[model samples]
Target: MSDRYELFLTCPKGLEGLLAEEATGLGLEETREHTSAIRGFAELETAYRLCLWSRLANRVLLVLKRFPMSNADDLYQGVLEVDWAEHLEPTGSLAVEFSGNGSGIDNTHFGALKVKDAIVDKLRTATGDRPSIDKMNPDLRIHLRLDRGEAILSLDLSGHSLHQRGYRLQQGAAPLKENLAAAILIRAGWPRIAAAGGALADPMCGVGTFLVEAAMIAADIAPNLKRERWGFSAWLGHVPALWKKLHAEALARAEAGLAKPPLWIRGYEADPRLIQPGRNNIERAGLSNWIKVYQGEVATFEPRPDQNQTGLVVCNPPYGERLGDEASLLYLYQNLGERLRQACMNWEAAVFTGAPDLGKRMGIRSHKQYAFWNGALPCKLLLIKVQPEQFVTGERRTPEQREREREQAALGQSEPEVDNKKVESNQAPAQIEQARLSEGGQMFANRLQKNLKLLGKWARREGVNCYRVYDADMPEYALAIDLYHDWVHVQEYAPPRSIDPEKAQARLFDALAAIPQALNVDKAKVIIKRRERQSGTKQYERQATQGRFTEVSEGGVKLLVNLTDYLDTGLFLDHRPLRLRIQREAAGKRFLNLYCYTATATVHAAKGGARSTTSVDLSKTYLDWARRNLSLNGFSDKNRLEQGDVMTWLAADREEYDLIFIDPPTFSNSKRMEGVFDVQRDHVELLDLAMARLAAGGVLYFSNNFRKFQLDEGLAARYVVEEISATTLDPDFARNSKIHRAWRLTAR
Candidate 1:
């Protein structure tokens, strides 16, 4: 038998048991479990095997020796006393890692420096030449842990963080760590997943982490199959023949256990930016033939017939904290719930959320909720069982019925009723109509209201469910447009026939001339801002060029649009169908919106009898316009507005919203934030954050206008990202259908 030694395997928090199980499977004897670590005793060959097959461990360390150290000199002496020649070569490069809390050697770097010096000094004294320090990709890694007065030293057998499972060649923003992904699959019961023959999907899959993990589990492939080397390979006592034999034997065992394709695995998202990296990761994992990735939205995604089984859908959606606001996130969650109930009936769903209130909006009670951590923030992963029978009716139950059921259930319990009066007494009055305008501002508001009425009538007369409403009234220079649904079919207009600069100018004036008198806007108030589109500068330009337009509105909340500004200055015509969708479904639901550009959807939701509304965005200017829109429609300020980063906000909030709308900019660069945000690059983190805060039975309507967007395949397991692009296009945009893709996502 090979020499036996004690080992401590470290894993991400909550995965200690999994690592212990893996170690035991590899013939190691588990001795104990710590908070985030597992200790075991095994022969040197078993240690090599553990590094090769374990899925959830971050690293495997071989304990060298333990000693007591009260000062920095003691630390040096303890490190120098170890048999350095047993692990390090005189010509090799090494790195030392130190971790400890509440110790005299508190600074990890300083401790590491001391350890490195001692190792080199001991080696030089024994063999003249000492090993060098290599911080980046070291050949041999040493670990030092000092807890209280005790110090322990070990050699890192896993060269890199095991989370870097060799499957991913590329990554998108905040991709799920591989070890964490594997743990989630395990927690959700992967054995059951394989038996069900249902697809594994993540509708907001980013970087293919989930897809690869699923494939690995399905194929019985060891998670580290592709890893080229481990830190143990460079040790002085390394046995290449033994390790090779162990690796080859494990690979053969895994190959023998491989079965036919388990289920159809897929993912979808609206942003194209994630597709390449996702594909790269999938290909690197050797799963290019098993999993497929598509670009679409969750709002209208249809599951394949084969996927009709009660499979799992897991998603990590944006929480609106790093993305936008609670109200917008609510809108997104509501839409997600609606779509899941409509299309993916047989699927079991799991959503990882940091916000408990948002999880309530999924409408379905969770069969299991597991608490985990994404970085330092605490989060919950809710597993919801969605029976196929629940999809027979398209409509969600009324809010009154839902509330009544909760009350009855709460009262039916035999437990004594606790006094809840204090909770109610401390609650502020529901601020549903707090932002409504007074009668004094009725003149211009009335005109805008009349215009909305006319627009709705015209939409109905023409059977147009969606169209743009441009009010040129002065006070606000920005444009105010609404995407109406229900009455008018939203249509995507073809790229306007390319017109000569002069002709475009004439057309702008003509469209402006059509404003109705009841709306009461003078032509003189319209000024056209014009310029030329520079080469690289054109993409970044926000102002209109070669257009007949002028600043018309101030704070009065006027809808002044310049058609000459690129192609879409007047309105986002795609959401007309979605807004109508909200109006048809919004009765008696609370709404949340994030990155609410102008709150047009809020107006529609309120009109549809929404109980309350909250809008969040980074721009105070847009929030002001949203407030104006609510007031114009006779809706009270009961709707709240907040200006902050959505990610940070959701991390701390606990409120639940029934309807959510998430419409963020295609790309934005804020000096105060980390860096510029590209919707395609950041959708996974964004969707994860959003789903965390949705209320049960809620709907989330998420969209982005990156014309060439493609979806990430890993997200399919969490969200059923459906393509609602066909329904979102306006009639005017028939010539060019690539407007925007909208999706709805829900837990499981």
Candidate 2:
């Protein structure tokens, strides 16, 4: 085997950058990050160093060979050519891991079997002793990656994922992987903080992963020092003498680190069940004296007085699932924010959470947010500078004192002190900023407050938590605002040529500012979108991909909507009236929904006791959202959602429906479709196709959002069409009657 070879260091998604940095720091050459793994070149010694020291890597794979092949037989032949005796004894045990989907051989099981057969047959022919397959830990672990007929064969230097640091003797429910917790710490700047003699804390440390990783970094202890076994132990390629020297050096460093006073590491778990397990893990890692874990709730968490006044407070807070009620979790988050503000002023913080809304409930502003994935769940690691001045202290004052502050504000008096420093002098930067907002921004803020007051009560009376609170109420703003629970969504209409673009932007910032104050929510929860003419597949283009979705209720039905992604927020508020009408009219009827963006209407119909519902849309993204909506509301087994062009699906579908809803886009020539579609130009043909799916005397709700659309008069004469535009307008969209036009049509 060559001394220098490509090392494939795999990590979790969104952690490749951190892993690459770790590999480079460990003396690897030419390190680069791809998708969820890092690639680099390292000698045998450096590769062993990574196995001992890397805190963010999942596995260290040393490539043996790379070749081209076209089929499974070719793979077998390629494997047989490699001298297996060089890496492992023919009498030893082996295990194989095969990944990658494409190529003629897509089955990983079959691929592994073929590779295994080749290895055994080659060894049996040469040495008369073939290795036995070990399903668990093996003397040699082989990894094969196949992509587009190209293969990379590598030896797994680490028997299992490096995240299993062997320190975790017991675990609680859903414990975080050790390497991921390490990534969160490194990204939060814990290494630098610890080096500077600062402390670290995890208020919600479940299994002591974060505490153990933090202690390792601060003490310069190798991450894998506690491992009892390694993949290279019994392999022929492993230079036992060289490995022994490296292990000795690592042991000396760890011994020297232990003699020094380690950075203060403390963790608190609210549940007694987790505290013992966390302590057991810390003890097993030989960190019982350095890192301590205790039972305590976040509501009462506090750092030891002997430690520094501030340090890095990092945590992996429970991100309650989207479908469950998380009322108590919100309070827990609030308490965490309070604890950080009151006790850890000047400290840095990193909160890893899947639910951002719950994070916002903390009422703290973050300096920066990094995206991460906890398995398939997209999460955010919010880096915040915990300054005490940003929180609300609720200082009480007499009415007279309040009047004085208000009058002083009116009279342009100097402001109160911040952190005991004068913050209102004209020379101060904060004062300069407070005076810099444009007039248009102030007007937009005032308008948002006005609209919120006007609609808040009406919304409460009508059980409308999600509605359009503002829709270009003043032309200068020219924006539509929506409220989905506690979140604010703003959509800016394309401005006319006569308007100045800079002024429009200032007004948008003004709106963003006013929303949090008026709605009593955090400004970080706001999502903004620009409305413009879309052609071809422009509407289907993703604006953002956080995989963030929230549940919103409408007329007693819960539907999932992604406010920060796509051109639309899944559910169209303008179609509220139409959806309600369909719900009332859909009892005991079979329903069909075409161009169903997220099947919100179909959900409504199914909730209203429709016999069965089928929704058709071309975008798989929307279809997945529709299915999630169905599952969220206990209707997963009751409805069917198909991903295909509405026209093609309609032609192939022969089942008759008692009710049908068609709401196509104004104009579309989507790449997924067979031909161009224009509601104005193709309305006749589209309606004819949809009409064929309706049962005798069945009703069809035909609609579209083309403002200037004119119905084909010939079809109207053939069918009984009643214009429902007047009744379909909700109170919030009353002034914009052209938001969407609809008509109930039945065959004559």
Candidate 3:
């Protein structure tokens, strides 16, 4: 055999540079980096040492031969010329793994079969016996990578991937592979910290992968020392003496490292079931004396090492996949930041996560960030120094107080000291993060105050308590602030992709800070929501289960609004003018409300002395809500709320109505409906059905919120159609004229 061998080390994506550095440190020569892999040259002893000590490599491949090939025949001939007897016994089992597709062999399985056939035929001719295939524990494992019409055949020296360190038998839902965990540790500077006798802790440790890898690093233990089986264990070229010497050296180093004082390494998991499994893994790695795992939550996690010793706090929190999950995980990240600030002073923190947006919500600034790939998903590792200066904290001072501080500074007087006791107590981190506002935030606050002063007079004069005060007044702060009695409902428009997420988030925080102070409302009464395009029933889904309703008045009618339950607060404030028009014109006439969400307009028609009222909707939940509204107004006798598909209901109803109001959703795909509802496509049929039920000389009021809606040209020819969209706009909705479109249709 040769004294020097060409070696290739494979790893997870995005770790090629780090692995190259590690391989060079481990005595590899002429290192070259590729995508997810590294190529180098090493002596037989160094190859054995790499197999024993490499923590970032997934596999260590020993290149045997490189040849040019263009077809399957060339592939077969290359393997046949390798002289199989020198590498494997005739009766020994082997497995072939092929990667890359080129030179007309596009299928990996077919390429592997072709290689196996060539090897078997060559060994049979040479030794009169063919080798059988044993895929699981093969005596020899050959890897063939075809790239750019070149075939590179190699032997896998490290079996079953170097990541399988033979310690972890049980893992959690989403466990990081051992090699990736080691990469994260190295990037977090764990090696230098461990050498300095520092400590390590993972607050959200799942199955203790970080703990085990860290302890092994601090104790100078070879990761694969306890492994029994390897791809080169039964190879014909195996050097027993060289491997033995290297293994002995590693054993001596471990023994000597263990004799020194143990470092402080610990992990805390919230799941009780994982505690035993984590401990078992640590014990199997033979680091039980150095590492310990306990069942604990992140909120109360306190790492008490030596008093003055500082270390690293590393964790991988869950990245939620659903929209609703982000709401709850937001608090989890905030709590983690709070605990770090309170307990881990002066320590370095490394938070690895797939959701960088949630990571920003932690209220701590990270000095450095590194990008990594966990399988196919992109992730980030945020490095922070847990110092007092890194904490985002300040008291929320008013404009007067800020001006006073500036004046005091000008007069050679010291600014008043903020009470640190409140911040250090059990107060929420978000509450303590009320720092000085930016110039844009101050301008936003001024606009809000100006809007309140102007709209307040209009609202009280019109007997309106729930009106929109501000709607995207400035482009930078994209939000709609509506007042419902003393509460403020703020809906932030989702920013476009061109906007930076961190800047948008900061602007949102500034807007939220300015809201309560500008409107003179309690912070608890401010309901914030993110507005984006909705499909199916997402717009109707309840955001909270507060189950509390508030009574409000408009045009001599009582209504109930549930601000916390849904995206829309029961009442459609933009349609106030249309509802009032229906009430005024419904005297002594039968009224029909189609697609009645909560029957708010139907209640107005009933209160306007309509002989009888009927409302149709698909949601039983909203039907129940409509029933409560009628009961709250004491007009349940002549009012009828039917829960069914509007299109299906309109087909079956033969009763004529003197007045009709139809407001349909832009799109709906509820399971209870036979087919999806698209207002743009089905409006003509809907309007035709409702017109057939309308009494002669009566009016049909049609409206929708679809901005792209085009009225059917055939309908105007069939009836006298006049667009009343401009007349439906109240002063509160004048800013957004396209909020809804209305039309008054009369039979000719």
TM-score for all models, in order of appearance:
0.56, 0.56, 0.72
Candidate rank order under lDDT? 3, 2, 1
Cα lDDT listed for each candidate: 0.66, 0.81, 0.87
By TM-score, who's the top model here?
3
**What tens digits encode model 3's per-residue C-alpha lDDT throughout 115-210?**
999999988854377899999999999999998999999999997999999999988889999999999999999999999999999999998999
lDDT of 1 by residue, 262-304 (tens): 4678877667898888888888777777788888766655566
Pick by lDDT: 1 or 3, better one: 3
* Candidate 2 per-residue C-alpha lDDT over 616-670 given as tens digits, one digit per residue, 9 for 90 to 100: 9998978988888888889977598988888888888899999999999887777
Question: In model 3, what is the error at residue 462, expressed in angstroms?
Answer: 12
Stretches of candidate 2 exceeding 4 Å from the true structure: 125-128, 306-308, 322-324, 388-748
Best by lDDT: 3
Sort every candidate by TM-score, greatest first: 3, 1, 2
